[model samples]
Target: MLFKNIVTIAASAAIASAEDVYLTVKSDDSSINGNVLGFPHEGAGLNYFFLGTGSATAFTYDESAKEISYPFAGSYTQFFTVFDNFVAFSVASANTEITFEDNVLALNGSTSNFYACKDTNDPYSYSTRSYELMWYASDAPSGCLPLTLVNSGSAAASSSALPSSTSASSAAPSASTYEGSAVKYAPAGAAALLAGAAAALI
Candidate 1:
């Protein structure tokens, strides 16, 4: 019984320490080749951006909870799709479990729901869009480009792939669009505040 218990604990610890996954787009265009998914440091109303690969966010997917989260200030923030136009990291209940297949991040196994909208004025910032359900790429909103998310491996494994200079200005653009979008950030205790605000409004 003691041996069995120890084995169980080890398995649990392995699951808890899952590998981190990085996200990047797959396209023939050289400019967008090295950009990765990330968000600004400020909380709320800021869209997720395709920052340079060196500064891309690292995420872990919990199969048991069916959720994807990134490390924040000593904790984890769940990724959520908001207004069907942008992705955000917050303390909300994020039920969607993003799956990676053949190097492409899919929404419930469908790849057509993801889109990347470029900011024509700022080539370094590319807004991301994720729908709850599958949406045809052909029917995507104007100024948005179909995105194929690829797993760039964990931090240690991806180190060699990083460019010498990780500055956003060094990143180039593969496409051009003029859509304005922003992502919302909610800290650990923001959920209660949001609930209270909603209750008062009602």
Candidate 2:
């Protein structure tokens, strides 16, 4: 029974390390509609990929309130490997405003990498849009980590097989694949749990 309890405690530590930040989106332009993809590590020479699709539930643009809201799916990640790009979207228009809770971090008038542009070969889409790339910076929260490193041979092998697309329904990498390469961070309560487990054993 003690052995089972110890194993459970270890599993709990792993789960705690995974964190998530919620974002609420809004834009003055009502016509703007589409999906968001983001590469967390800006330094990595990587292409942006779709993160979340546009829909009434996932993305609701309210012209009256000038806001857009997204359903909380483990859609956004605390871990970078869940997807590439911090947050990129192929919305119908260029200007956007992103919020975390009540804090307005990026605004429609403001154009940072948040509005950075890259040429798109998507036969179905056009126009440059704003994206939020979170990294450790003066303005950004310090609780950030660099892009995950994988064996070059492994990343190239994987990338070559998986063609990038702006499909609205793009899914995150499977758990087996991501967890294999994902860098797990210690969650807030992880240390306390580990200490408690050790004490119980003693």
Q: Judged by lDDT, which candidate is best? A: 1
Candidate 2 global CA lDDT score: 0.27
Q: All candidates' lDDT scores?
A: 0.45, 0.27
Q: For candidate 1, lDDT tens digit of each residue in 37-112?
A: 5453223322234434444456776655555665433243445343344455554566456666776777665665
RMSD of each: 9.0, 17.8
For 41-134, candidate 2 gives per-residue lDDT tens digits of 1112212332222211123333333333322122322222212223433212323443322333333322222322223222212212332333
Structural RMSD, model 2: 17.8
The parts of candidate 1 lying over 4 Å away from their true place are: 1-17, 41-47, 53-55, 74-76, 80-82, 119-138, 156-163, 167-202
